[model samples]
Target: MPDASRITPPVVAPTEAPVNPVSMHIRLDPGMPLAHLESVYHAVNTEKNAQGIYQLTLQDAQVPANRDFELLWVPAPGNAPQAALFNEQWQGDEYALLMLMPPAPAPAGATARRVPREVIYVIDTSGSMHGDSIIQARAALKLALERLTTADRFNVIQFNHQTSALFSRAVAATADNLQRALSYVDRLVADGGTEMLPALQLALGQQPEQGVLRQIIFLTDGSVGNEQALFSLIHQQLGDSRLFTVGIGSAPNSFFMTRAAQFGRGTFTYIGKVAEVGEKMAALFSKLETPRLTDIEIHWPQDQPVEMWPARIPDLYLGEPVLVALKLQQPNLPLTLTGDAAGVPWQQQVTLRGGAARSGVHQLWARRKIADLMDQRAQGVAEPEVRKAVLDVALTHRLVSRYTSLVAVDKTPSRPADQGLENKALPTNLPQGWSATKVFGSLPQTATASEWNLLVGLLLLACGVLFSRWPGVGFGVRVGPVSDGKAHGGNVL
Candidate 1:
């Protein structure tokens, strides 16, 4: 795992202090189906014996270079569609979970140790995070400071209905500076309703010119009322800096935390237990140090009929593997690829000629891409015409798709009108779970030449019978059986 300090170079003199790097946040939604979840996380294990409402399980993964981070999420009974958004960071060997469903209590073994970084601990001392919440918040910040080095620069921010900065901008991490910051944190007693928007705006506006990575570690229970307003602002300003969010208590709303990080391109975590702060910090520091692949873009030829999920991929974190699904028109074709690797441009070509006969792999890839397309559609960014085109192809191939399905219909008619004969009546099927809604017309009947011949023969037989019954025609009657002794009963012809 790369230490967070790795991103920042040390300053040689007093005037050359570096800017602290900020964390990024990513949000997740609950309505994610099992297939969608698998696409996000590399590992998903079905418990062999554990039977319950929540059937999926996730195991913690070590951060590996060149791979994406994996996060496992299991739904609670009756969980809503947009329950939570999770953020995670991968160190080389260990993955740091930033958020999850109901935001599970931080691991008992979890801890946050601040790594050497020019740092700023932005605490929301607003009245919203008061009492026990305030106390825990203070402890979390203290724990964070314990990991800093004197080489780092730091400051604090406390916001309520009003906002205040401990120092105008970044402060050196000298003993006096640390003392002043600690004093400010200790003196923080939460009061007043949360007015977080201006505080964040001010915190970000204080960016220093120091070459070090600039960061703002936001501490809050995320209870501010104006979440939408704050989200809009975060979305607007995130590109300027990195922001990490720490949700202080059990009820802390982690949604805002996750959104803030995502917009700011940083990490989001819920700190339910103060004791575990140090370890979590350690994991985070390692991630900050590593840069597996920057500006990753995966591409393939246009004619391959291959669809890649997550058309817009995010940064690859420690330990998480990047999984790409390819739908190939022909299996043996060689595919050209190009992308940036850690700031350097590179290109490679790969052949998909190997044993693709493995059961279910292709199906899995198809399902994943389809799901991704659905997600894009839901976001309202997908082009309807293009999507419809893709859907048609999926239907023709009978591939699993979000919008198309193989539907069964029954065509048995209950009455003469329903027989779907003349009068332009259309045929209607009795779908298992559905009722007929329209009576547009009748069924179309097409007969073969042989069937027509049979119909003509029957018509001729009927005509002959009617002609024989005409008044001028002779009739014969036999009253007795042919073998009868009387043989009598004339046959009058």
Candidate 2:
């Protein structure tokens, strides 16, 4: 047997400043001798066991986000080319596992041709979106509108407490119409509650023109409480309309934005800084203009029982690959994928091969499963049942989720329960380009006609009550009986 004691841990310098604590684990194929372990960042702790699995924990900092896989594979004598494996368990159960990169772009003029698009821009102008948030949103919308061609149809919908469209229906992206849209977006102000449901309904309700790609680009801080409702609406009305979300704040609600885009079968973009608005929106426009891979399906070996997360595959943007984690009973099984690109059918097949054992793939898969379960809960699954399922998966994988959080407890108690606990809030810096006065000073104009209508309704109701009690008043005409004999002595007004 090869001596596992002879292996040496890699010596690597830290690549980047760590923003959050990260932990990683790697499991090698059974009977595979540990030749070496290498990483770009020094691991705070490294431990190897009899089962050929290695675990590493990084405290406070880890490798840079942009860096590729840390473990560099060194093939042993007569070893085949090895793909990367994050984590695995070798139990008696049968399952399947596979990972694949995005297919290369088809040869020039060989793939499906681009389709004309009908773009709808839905922007949130709620109170929380004041300052830099609204500014970035407006700039992004202008960029998208400028990219539309004359052959395309386009419209703009701005929502706060009420929803209003730039046009009653989508109009040709003429120069005049595009200019009008830019001006309309420029005049939008951040105020009122985030009424996204109505805006989404209006955008999705648009009739799809033949041969035109219907897409909705939504920009918001995602600061709404009714995220589930919006998600359900998107799922129900999605039809052929793809919804992309542009997160537009320093600390936007990422959970809502990411899942919404997933349900809408589109991609999500983040614009944390004003400078990134142009760059991010430009990238998004590229995806919008290109043909996307849709109706993707993966076929695994029939002999292997496979369990995968994100059971519903999302549409692939340009250069975006389909990634999934599977608990397989066997390794090195061949797989096939089929999908549609534009209007043409596309398919690919690959034979799985042994590769270098990487780390974190299992945890990534677990995170995806948890997200899917939560999405199901949002879609009306029983809360207790979904919570239980999520908790079991999270606890088994030791992941952080809505039902599970990583908490550190001290064995020795420093303070008694009777000492009482004091709550302190931490102050956060204002988002870049935001003004404190605008955000906190005076409230913007958010009052809507609904308030006036409510007052009028109350007044009318009171007047009716008074008139009923004092029939002598001439505020309303009263009839003692109906001429058609519908009523004998009933009062009518």
Candidate 3:
């Protein structure tokens, strides 16, 4: 196993003040009329896990008190759609709005019979889910299993380095099956690397069950990186299937869960603690039971070409507000919303004029637009086009996108020209309670570069290949400690 101890650098005394300082040369355009500059500094961020909910055992009945806080939610119009407008610094009029769809009464006889659903519950059993995370996951899955009705067929899938299912396929939600699933979930102990692609493939690669609504519920902290591949898979294989995300653990990746749900045309629910699992899962299931407005469309004033995101509107669920970002030439124009709920046509009109004038709406629009471009790039869009478009919006709005970053550039140098810059990388300690096995397949980014005096015991065999055109072909290096008051040396072949 790799060394787990933290390595600290030699402490510098307060009296010593003779060292080489480092600086950068930032070139500025001569044509600029005005430019501002400041010193660049980065404050290190440290995260302390104070949830006090780790290593919880099944027998531990003592639940930790949840830290509560008051929330201030400005309610929007319940009867009509609402909008928030912001005029961007650039040319276009940017705005963001919540396309709230009041529950449309289903058509007569349309809701007489409930549709059977094929629910596939997937839980991540990776090493990151080892403490309270896994416990919360188990609790969420248990509650979800209890909510299954007799008309629904369900299966439980758990994944780490490998994927396993309670049943080979979806089975009827009978008492026997539910009991078996509950047992399987209870026995799950998080202890392996996260290989999420295989699990996603197994869950979504199959054909949807006939005459049943297919829904995939993922309960995980979403620590698996490389979300681009997963998003692409969900986009390609999602055929008439909805995917709901249940974020487990305190530090669950909200971006990943939310985006996965967006691509799967589903909703995202978060369970921060074990105590909140039942209520959150119950709310999610309640939304699933309500009517979903599908085939949503927006009608903007025809005075200018309007850019709206997501380019394709998603289905609306109960009490879930659809946040829409728009770019238009006019701000106060009326826009119409159209959709169908259980074969019943739904329509509402709202103008952005009387809506609250909120700040940062333009930033929201830019961020969503950038995300839309990135989604396209993931779906095989041209790299240059996407980069150029994203860079333009990101720079004009001064927002950080995947392509653009804000770097503080000083007009003057911090050190003398003759002083050579020496950069020393500091070692980063391993995260508390984390295993070195977490980095088995990848290089450790926290490892620092330090001086190593290798003692190559007398050269047993020497071979060297001098490069002509290609320099990194091969090389022979030999060095040893000094002997007899003389330094031992060898060729850098």
Best by lDDT: 2
Instruction: Name the better of 1 and 2 by TM-score.
Output: 2
**Global Cα lDDT for candidate 1:** 0.52
lDDT of 2 by residue, 9-40 (tens): 11122332333233455544433443445553
TM-score of 2: 0.68
Which parts of model 3 are misplaced by more than 4 Å? 1-96, 101-113, 301-303, 409-493
How far off is residue 301 in model 2, in Å? Answer: 3.4
lDDT of all predictions = 0.52, 0.69, 0.67
**Structural RMSD, model 3:** 14.4
